[model samples]
Target chain A: MMTGAAAIAAGGAGSARQPRNAALPAVIFAIFALMPAFAALTAQHYLVDTGTRIIVYAVAAVALDLLVGYGGLISFGQAAFIGLGAYAVGILSAAGIGDALVSLPVAIAVSMAFAWITGVVCIRTKGVYFIMITLAFGQMVYFLATSLAPYGGDNGLTIDARNTIAGWPVLKNDTAFYYFAFLCLLATYLLCRALIASRFGRVLRGTKENATRMAAIGFTVQRFQLIAYVIAGGIGGVSGFLLANSTEFVAPAYMAWQQSGELIVMVILGGVGTLDGAIVGSAVYLLAEEWLSGLTENWQVIFGPFLVLVVLFARGGLIGFCARLRLRHG
Target chain B: MTATLFFVQVLNGLQLGVLLFLIAAGLTLVFGVMDFINLAHGVQYMLGAYLAVAFYGVVGNFLFALIMALLASLAFGLLLEFLVFRHLYERDHLDQVIATFGIILFLNHAVRMVWGAAPLTLPMPDAFTGSVLLAPGQLYPVWRLVIIASGIAVAGGLYLLVTHTRIGMLVRAGATNARMVSALGVNIKRLFMIVFGFGTMLAGFAGVMIAPIISVEPGMGTNILILAFVVIVIGGIGSIRGAFVAALLIGLVDTLGRSFSIDVLRLVMAPSPARTVGPAIASILIYVLMAIVLFLRPAGLFPARGR
Candidate 1:
């Protein structure tokens, strides 16, 4: 059942030997690490703000790749966990509790709890049904957020101040917050890389490659998938926590299906299953979106066809395309 | 609830159900036959409303506008199939989902560009303009009843078309096993085009029928599109019967839950908490139903593919 395009995309370190550019990830990180300096040099505070947003989304997209690319789970509800995380911060803060130590754990725990409950139900189905059920769950969360009037409901809630880190307002400074987000992104990426190279990762990838075979070999496929889903949800929660702090606002729109779709697009565009690719995809997508919308309000009219053409012609996404180009030239 | 109010709600629920069925019928058929997930299906419904409005401006008659809209929708759908979707049928579901999502984004924005961002409306036809008495002092809008009638009629017609005709047989066989059907000398591509076109038209039809009541706006399809997906999932993918039953059930549950959840909750909980929780619960009721259905029957109620 493996198509040529899928085969090419799935050829991460496991199948094909690399072309000896292992420093690609380090280079990307180095670039991100130096972005703040670049922003400072350019004296563009908006660039830092936009970079922080990209880093936050990159964290979410990387987590999604863990499920979609490696675990063979296409969850349309990943944004729900992010929303849960953000709402945890917003609700606790609104109730006069703005400590990151308390709110961060609550955010992660709540999202994981949701992931566990919904994952248990969602893992029962496969293929299109899985996609639809995840979407249903996401919409349910979105509506729940809209109905929470005490927390500002559909109008959304704005925090008076960002979460204090151990009674310190280190995050109140924009540069400091950007660095914090960058660190979170780095941690998330490294964590994903480690997870994908572990015994657990091997089993998850094996199940993805052939679930029936894994089942026949006495592996409970659902358990591994559920664990992966929960892990992804936790990471998504972390991103959500950062997102709330970044904007100092939490809205139901954060968990809208469109956001989920954009996350999926990021994964696909960056080359699904590729951790660094997800990061790059987020950067490209957000930057393009910001740049294009500035050009015309109807930018999606152009962006949409571009996506279609990419899916049609660019089988493996940007990373895949880069790989092909290197192979041709080198 | 009062009997009249309950009856009126039920009619509203039925109207909503029929509209869902019209959208889901085509959606499920495409999924069943081609295994293609068209996220753009909702935009087709939006297009239908927009086309109806455009045609109405020219024809100045609702009936003629409806016919022209349907025809235009069919042609537009076929064009999309020819241009974009035709290449996607062979790709995986992820590819189909992404490509169709792109179509959704394009069309939604395209409509906004062409029609402006303002909400547009079509007046109810003169023939179905007023309210009709169902019981003493229980009057309902004639147009809503008309929508319900037409939806049911479309469903009945779809049932006949899917069950009786040669194309229907091919569709059934394809849903059961596409490769087997194609191997039997069936032109799967042509079958796919036909199925895609019909699904697009049904979605458009639902949009046109509901346009008079709801504001015709850009991105109108995205909300209902999700509902249709829920219906298809609950009904069981690839099963028209499943879609019909699920759509109506969802319509009733969603409508009734929203209308009476607070009252229902107040009996067990305090009024304040009930008020806060009721709408949230009501909005998620169908999704909860879907989760339960999937847990109970993973393949859905009437899975076209055998267990």
Candidate 2:
């Protein structure tokens, strides 16, 4: 799994040379896995809840990183998939269908369908055009969600209960739900890791570097990008499913362009091209948000400048910044 | 009644187009000249409205408040450019987007802190408070006409500035090839600041103009910002003419779509379903148009850059 060729293909070689880089992901996961115990010791249920939220966002951010960081597709509409996933569960639950098996697949299928259609139009344009088109599609989804009056519309819909695995409320327990979200995050991270190392991933990366060259090499770049977009949208649906179950609510706000922007910010904050960076970035961002909002109603004033500083100073985000430190010391 | 509604909506659409052009002109110029994406541009518009409110409190004259707000908005925009944006011109688009987004977040919250969350209003100038009859039983606001006129004036002024002036030639050249313009010994930095300041003032002017009609509030710029983005994208990123055409096109389409979508939908579907689906379709109409445009002309109707 740690072969030289695979590492290079994964864009991991530069970071792989740094010894601390090898252990960072394992350390991050260990921290997450033990977070339940830490929460129990402190008797802070809020920690577990917030932790669950962070992990769920990490899942979306990782999926986003696949398209944005790896494929150079700065999709400003990833939240639409997340919204679709939540709405799938919300709509199904409203109809008295609470089975995870049924709703989760429906969510993914719906999101993929959306991604397929929108990605086709979006991938036709590049640079700023790509960003705006994705945003438009996202807005379209948001407006559609708000118009869904029967399913609660702009006010949002609350689920009576979480999705049951084969009619068993296994996720009813907080720790169980936390581990479930953790597992989902781990699976998504590994899947992205594997995807980026495959031949398909190489072609995607090649296109990001130079689409014309990729086309010259006989890869229909748009087809590959569209496939990547659909894959990301499906994974985003997973996060949305988890989110709806975790919070037991879904609203048009979930799919707003702001949410999509936050997802992109998470990827950038973590380090755009690094898979582990996405997870770390999501954790840092959400935790800071929770902490800041607790401190002041005007938390964005602080958070906004923080983001500007990050962009100005922290070139590669937390992960990149850390790697740079290692290079300097070593 | 139908004809009256149609006439009123067209005027409303044109009014909306004029406002959008004011914002989009600056946005397109900044994008064209510097290749910088400023998500906070909408905040400048919001700031303009807010400034007009505060200045009105001090100056006690609408015209004076308007001038003061424009100057303040220009200064504030230039300050931001000098402090934050100037550093980001050479960075990735994502970085520019994120950094500017941060500015938006900061300012929106900061404005909320200063002014409170409640939406404030600017009084319509006394000179233009009255309505004029277009026909029998059809009247339109004079202030709106003033907006349309002022927008046309600004567009005309910008056309002269960009096409006939030396600075305008440099801006056009920079949009087409910044590196070449820089190599030719033009002070690209000064040019960026000038372009940025002018664009900011345009957005602010739009804000002040519309403030009397709409509520002045923090985050009011967000939706308009999205609409402005839609304008520039459809207009082609760097072309002022494209922005003007696309802005009006969008304005008419959106206004007409929202007003008539239900009527059109009723022709094809049952009334209840039509009522429910109408607003949703209307809201998405511009995006659908954008998709079609991108599908047909990937670059836009009037791309400034050479393909």
Candidate 3:
């Protein structure tokens, strides 16, 4: 019904969206690949840290875009999946299992298991109910994390060390960890783009537009969404794994509803439905947090109204705005 | 737990229930009638308490402070409606969520700016002070009973207003289908304003009433706001009756669960495991209940007529 400005935001390679801006992803990834080198030259090691954080969150953002943008499944519980992922790493590391081989699979499997179970329930509800239920589930997961006193509970758990890659301490190096994160982001972006281009993706997108029609066409709408949800959750787990390793800590706060909200903000900030938008949105949001908070302690006071102004005027987010500008200039 | 102790817990649950209902009533109506998701509604609640504290300082009268605080809350709600929410009625739910989330951020911090980051307090009136002996050793506070009675009165008054009034009829019809009512020559915008303002006042009222019992602090409403959402969802989006039932149910379950989860777990499990698992289960008990309810009744307990 709302096939107006919002539908435009729900863009793909070939739909009602603007011309395929393939160069955008290339530019973004190239920038990501070179950031560490730039940091080396500039002697801003913190820039590497910021870049790694951006990459880790970008993976989750890409996953979130798959649901909120492509599928019209807005799960407010994205942070829960991330939390589950992070905690998997934290718990394993605390148990003296610091290898990625064990921790990585454990993280993805745990979050996917959580995703599958919750998605079974979450996919049944539609629209606002979906949002609320996901939120409720996210809160449940957050509370569980807070209650785990053995693994540090509310205080969160600090890893003894960064994860080793197959008996080698590759990720122990800051530069290597940054590259690992960048690789994860790259892989996630490509994987999602491939998925979206498949027939399954088309069916998922179809359900978003009109579920009744898709049902009539003999597609199991719920199955497609549930798979997408689980996939998104796995990606969230991967993000969580990196998040834990990068910081060498995991906390229940990582799964706070506010974190989920911020992830949504990242999705919308770049423009939803587009993987390119997801990455850009993550970089921009994290950068803003880094830059703005440095300006003053009360940066959100300014950020809050700025967000309002953005929603009021910037319909398609930063990426959409840029597209609009380019079109106007053309 | 002893019978008297259980009874005390039930009363406490009732107190929580009525407080939740007061917040949920406004929240459910706005959501039902307007289909707006105002995350900032919690801050409006916080605003109510803060305003009451500020007014009490000036007026030095609890009743007068409550009245002034309510009026101020209504005014502020209308202002927010005019400035922000009025434009968002046509947008989808995601946009509504983001915009309101921004308001929550602004308001929570704005609150800190106005009142320092430290928690503030409002003294209870002398009239409601002291405890009444309900049994041989059970002494219940008078103020809690007052909160319970007042909450019941508000709920009853709300029920009457919604069932018997012209505005009530419009609201019910609007919840069923807003566009149809708008098309039928009713001023849906005005109806929205009334609902929003009234909802704001109800949240504020809850804030004012509970101020004496709980510390008034920044971001205090975030957690309770979540509970209110849980209430409205379980009760059904647009049904006041559902909200009442769900709120009280949640109040009881949550209160009782926290009080007895350890004991309940101890019966079937080892004491060490029970002690460790008890608080965790207690905290998530309401969510578990909500998940079960959603699985059973996706639309909620008493969804208003259409949606």
Candidate 4:
């Protein structure tokens, strides 16, 4: 059932292709890549910070889409992995292992281990239960972090310095880190695109559409889904790493369920199951939040209703809304 | 720990358990009947407490305030159902979660805007103000006793309603298969409204009742909501009896663990290490219990749905 869904999705991709618009996303990305440089040149430090946040969260949102949209796994604990990654960096740096190479692997390993254990129990459930169980696991992790009094606990940990690459302060400079993040985002996009097109990806997508049929066809549905979850988790961990460095602090609040909900909003607001949509969603979401907060302290009072309207009226989110408009115009 | 301290905490745990049962009962029923997960159910609880406070300010009588609060909560819940929840019944769990989460955000902030960010307190009724001595040097408050007695009574009443009443049969039937009940000309929509409204009221009732003892504040319901979810999952969804039992178990375990975890750990390890490890373990005890339950019985201890 899922294999057929994949084929149909692939067919849609082919039919929906427009030659002129093929490079639109790339052009948009290039503009985004240059945003920080423009900010730095203009001496807009706050802009640089906001841009870095967008890139980091965008990376996490894209990873989230891979699991929720493509793989049919709705996780409410993506922030847990991100927090784990952030904590990995913090704990290691505190222990004097401040190298990017060491910290990155440690983050990935910690997140992967957590995902493996939690995903085992979480995968057995489906639908609403799946969402809640994932949430419960996330809360469990948050509480554990809060109890770590030795490492700041509820007060959170502060990094002494940003991570260095081979003992050079390559990542400390705002422009360099922004460019590094952009490169990572680009690589992540390409890698996710490749993975989704592979034979493995096909099987994974199959399980999402119809697990029973896929199982009947002798595919190990659980294994594929688990791999997808781990991959998503690892990517989320990368987002945490960026977030910690960006904020210069890591807290249990990073993994709270509210953060997870915001990540999902980013996924849906962009349009689910689309790689580019994740980036678009993140950019739109974070920008709107930043803009709204500037307008009022209680921006969510208005934003909440706006979200309800979006979910009800806009089926496929902003991308779908735009697509409909263009079709009518065309 | 002294026996008096132990006994006092146990009673406290029981009281907490009862409040959880009231909230969880309605939650599990809604899920069982509609196949819906309402994260905003906690907001209903918060609203209940807020309404109680408002009503009390007007009537200045505990009974009048309680009744008004319950009615207000029912109306608010039905309003939400009519406006937002009705559209979501057919949607996936993710959509339900997100929409409900949005509701939580809106309501929490709205309450803050109206009630301020500080915790609000409902004064205990003068009639239930004094303490009754349970043991030597152990005096428990009358209001807490009232909560315990009322919670158990409600639980008993619910058991009777579900097992022996005509509506109970329909509820059980609905839990098993909602479509089948609808096919039987049971007016599933009306049933849904009753179940939803009743659940909302129960949660609200819990909030109002506990307001005097605990801080009545914005976002007060979120943590408790998660705890209620754990109870329903452990008790087996759709089972009132399961919710009742699970709520008590969790209340006892969590309350007792928080109080005695360090003491328990001290027997096996040094005091310093125990102090650190104790609180962490106590916080996670319910989850560990849940994991164990899931391993043994994935559907929970008494699932409404059969194998």
TM-score of each: 0.97, 0.96, 0.97, 0.94
Stretches > 4 Å off in candidate 1: A1-21
- Candidates 3 and 4 compared: the better one by TM-score is 3
Query: What's the lDDT for all of these models?
Result: 0.89, 0.90, 0.89, 0.84
Record all residue pairs in model 4 with backbone atoms less than 3 Å apart, i.e. clashing.
A2-A206
lDDT (10s digit) by residue, model 3, range B232-275 = 99999989999999999999999999999999999999998788
Docking outcome class, model 3: medium
lDDT tens string, model 4, A72-180? 7888889998999999999988899888899988888889889998888888876555676788788889889988887898889999989998899888888788888
What tens-digit string does per-residue lDDT give for candidate 3 at A208-327?
877888999999999999999999999999999999999999999999999999999888878777778788888888888788889966667877887787778876777777887888
Model 2 pairs in collision: none
The candidate that wins on lDDT is: 2
DockQ of each: 0.58, 0.53, 0.55, 0.38
Residue A251's lDDT in candidate 2: 94
Q: Rank by DockQ, descending? A: 1, 3, 2, 4
Kept native contacts, fraction for each prediction = 0.68, 0.69, 0.54, 0.35
Error of 1 at A119 (Å): 1.4
Tens digits of lDDT, candidate 1, A138-229: 98999999989888988999988999999998999998999999999999988988998898998998888778889999999999999999
Task: Write down the DockQ of candidate 4.
Answer: 0.38
